[model samples]
Target: MSTGKVVLGTVAGLAVGGILGILFAPEKGSVTRQQILDKGNDYADDLKSKYNGIAETLKEKFQAVKNDAENIAQSGKAKFDEVKNEINRPAANY
Candidate 1:
């Protein structure tokens, strides 16, 4: 499995376990609910961070690939122009 998937699964498992433990404990209901809510918020923040990082990385990679492609196209065009110029040059008189 992918690292993201693994991390998500682990986080989900831990969240569920925490909820179960809280339910079984003698703690007040309000505190347990608050803990669950806090954990959920934290998980959401983590996911947002992960997604943002991935998006930034993907954008960078796309820009790099686009730059390389443009360079190759420019080089090809230059070579074509050079060849065309050579072909069009006048031949020496007999």
Candidate 2:
């Protein structure tokens, strides 16, 4: 149902269909085997590239969230410290 799933299904279907077509075509056994091997390698490389891209995007998103959390924590701590200091001050200092 998701876009990623649809795309993956479509790609898988296309690869399977292409390999089947090549298998059924009239050709020398060696040639047919070579073609299948070439196609498989190409598909593997493409999948690896896509995986790396997705991994990089996830890493960037994770880093951004981590930075935001750190900033929020620092801000909260600074406010707490300021309040504590104020509370401990002498009434004459107010």
Candidate 3:
């Protein structure tokens, strides 16, 4: 979530920065508009790539945590069964 927010903020910053920079440039109106459009598209692509990478990383981490929890639960269940069997064993006759 935080990574998504950061990417959003970055794209916003780039857009604002590009607009401001283009506004001050000496180019004609049509050329400036085109430049801004191109820049916006580039920034959009960058944001998409970054967000996808973050999503992949998060998925991997989540899977790892889930696997760890399952292993711990299995170990605990095995230990309980061993203790239970030991307690239920019959006593030897005299």
Return the top candidate by lDDT: 2
Candidate number that wins on lDDT, 2 or 3: 2
* lDDT of each candidate versus the true structure: 0.86, 0.91, 0.87
Q: Which is superior by lDDT, 1 or 2?
A: 2
- 1-94 per-residue lDDT for model 1 (tens digits): 8987998898889878877877788878898788778877887898789889999999999999999999999999999999887777754322
Instruction: For candidate 2, give the lDDT of residue 46.
Output: 85
- Model 3, 1-94: lDDT tens per residue? 6955876787798789989999899999999999999998898788789878879999999999999999999999999999887777744321
**Segments of candidate 2 deviating more than 4 angstroms:** 91-94
Pull out the clashing pairs in model 2: none
Residue 14, model 2: lDDT of 76
Q: Give the TM-score of candidate 3.
A: 0.79
Task: Give lDDT: candidate 1, residue 61.
Answer: 100
Looking at model 3, the pairs that clash are none
- Every model's TM-score: 0.81, 0.89, 0.79
User: Over the full model, what C-alpha lDDT does candidate 2 score relative to the true structure?
Assistant: 0.91
lDDT of 2 by residue, 1-94 (tens): 9967986997798789879989999999999999999998988898899889989999999999999999999999999999988888866586
Cand. 1 TM to true fold? 0.81
Question: Model 3, residue 18: displacement in angstroms?
Answer: 1.4
